[model samples]
Target: MGNKEQTFQKIIEIAYVMFAENGFEKTSLAMIATEVGISKPAIYYYFQSKDQLIAYIFDELYKEIQQDIAVDYKELTSANFKEKLLELGYKSIEAQGKDPYFNKIFNQYVLLAARDESYKSQLVELETSFLTSFVEVLQWGVRLGVLDDTPHIEAKAQMLALVYDNIGNFMLTGNQLNYRAIWKEAVHSVIQGGKDDK
Candidate 1:
């Protein structure tokens, strides 16, 4: 790429490492610039502010995670949610484990989003997109007669996502537990129960 694009990418790379190490609050633009071998103004040429930089880093990273676990929407019509969701849980865990440092930045964004309305909106939008996809999968399972038809599919989807997320958080912290067993139990509980039940 050109110098401008190169510099911008370099900024993101260094900033991610710093944020992972020192956190968003402790990381500074000057520090990123120093590590990137650029001036503070140079960093500004690509980002308007520290928040913008952090936001950009998070957006790009989140997109990467999404791509890592991306499901083929066409495959959602299959009647095997038990296997599909189990695979999804495994992929979710892998996504978090792929970049051990991402959770740090993710938690930082959670706190910042709580206090900042703009950040909160962005975070909510990101979560909504993720949740919608998950809900679609569960709904498809219902249509295929593989999973119980629940009117509250959205809530069940959110719960399943949280289960995977919690397991991922544990893995991030080096928690020593039977993650596979726990993940299987949790996924089964969410999808095992139907409109046509006996």
Candidate 2:
């Protein structure tokens, strides 16, 4: 990579660690520069502002997840519908758990967006892309008859959003509930009367 590319990547690496550890608000460019063994001005050469850095991280995370799902989609042709659905559930959990610090950054992002209309719109777009993948999986399940057809795919999307909210809550509160068991019960509740009895 060129020096510019290398420096840009280094900045992202430093920002990821700091944002993960200190969160977006608590993290500062000076701290990231200190960690990167570079001056603050050097950091500026790569990113104009901390918000940009945070946005970059969001983009990176989204791209990585979409790539992962694309790979999984290609391999699911032979898998049974139940197996694919379970795989998707597991993948969703794993995606949230990607970076140990991702949860903190994610929650902070949500809070920031809530207070700022512009940030809220950008955040909605980012989150929509992330959630859309799971929505697609759920739609696929319905198509395969593992999950019953809802009139619209969006109801399932809303259900998955609740699931995502649960993950964010687990990250924020460190609540000790048995999430696995809770999820199983919740999923059953959502689909109980809807499944085709064969």
Candidate 3:
């Protein structure tokens, strides 16, 4: 890479660590510039403002996560529905284990979204986009009659998302909380009451 490109990437890396550690409200562009060994104007030459930089970093991370999940879709097996889903969940959590900063950054953005309309909109869009894949998989499971549809497919997908997020949290922090087992039982006990009526 050229010197400019290298510097730009280094700035981003430093800013990512700062943002992840200090969060959106606490991190400052001056701190990032100082950490990157550049003037504040130099940072502005690359990004218009702190918000823009934060958004760029968030967008990149979000895209990377979506791509990671999409690629994992190919690894899913023909096992029983719940087992396959649990496998996917396990895989998803395992991926997070490889990158501790990602979920921290992601969670930071989510909390930032509460006070920033632009961030809120982007976060909503990101969630919807990611959920589409999960919804499709759940719909397929329902059609095959291998999964329950009691609370409905969409709700099931959302619950699965929550379970995965919690499991990821547990894995990242090494928390003693046992959310995984509870969520697994919840999925297994969806009651099979929709189209299958079991």
Candidate 4:
């Protein structure tokens, strides 16, 4: 990468660490600049404000997650649909676990969203995209005859998303529950529409 691109990425990486460690309110542009060994004005050259930098951070993080758990719906077969979904759930959990600060940073952003309209809008857009992807997966299942064509598909996807969100919340709170087991149960429940007797 060019020097400019490298410097830009360095600023972002430093800001991410500072935000995760010191929090959004506590971490300032000067601090990030100091950590990046750049002038404070240099940060402004890339990001108009700390809010813009954080929003960029969140946008990049979401894109990384989407790429990590992406499923090729067209490649799925009825026989492998459940397995693929289970793998997706596993990957989501694994990704969160891979970054010890991710859940903390995510929760911080959620709190930031409550007081900032721009953050709230960005979060809403990210969540909507996530839910839309889940719905698309469910639609693919229906098309493949793996899932029943039901009117509540969107609601079911929301429930599954909630499960994943709660799992992150639980982990962030130092909960010792078996998250994988919970995830498996949630996946099966959503797949069966809560009618799974097995």
For all candidates, what are the clash counts?
0, 0, 0, 0
What TM-score against the true fold does each predicted structure earn?
A: 0.82, 0.72, 0.75, 0.83
User: Which residue pairs clash in candidate 1?
Assistant: none
lDDT of 2 at 47: 86
Model 2 agreement with the true structure over 49-116: per-residue lDDT tens digits: 98888888877876764575542555554235444454455666666665566667666767878888
lDDT of 3 by residue, 1-198 (tens): 998999899988988888877887888898899998999888899999998998789888878877755624444433456666655666666576676777777789888888889889987887787787777777777666666565677887777676766776666576756554655565665524322211
Tens digits of per-residue lDDT for model 1 on 1-198? 999889888888888888987888888899999999988887888889998888788788778767755677566554455776787777666666677787877888888888999889988887777777778777877777777786777898888777776886788689988776787887777766522111
Off by over 4 Å in 2: 1-6, 65-79, 129-136, 150-157, 188-198
Candidate 4, number of clashes: 0
Model 3 quality (TM-score): 0.75
Clashes counted in candidate 3 amount to: 0
Q: Local error of candidate 4 at 133, Å?
A: 2.2
Q: Please write out the lDDT profile of model 4 over residues 62-169, one tens digit for every residue.
A: 788678656787779977787778787777777777777888888888898899898899889888878787888888888988778889888888888788778888
The C-alpha stretches of model 4 lying farther than 4 A from their native spots are: 39-42, 68-70, 192-198
Which predicted model would earn the best lDDT? 4
Q: Per-residue lDDT for 173 in model 1? A: 82
Q: Pick the candidate with the highest TM-score.
A: 4
State each model's CA lDDT, in order: 0.77, 0.68, 0.73, 0.83
Q: Please identify model 3 stretches exceeding 4 Å from their true place.
A: 71-84, 148-151, 171-198
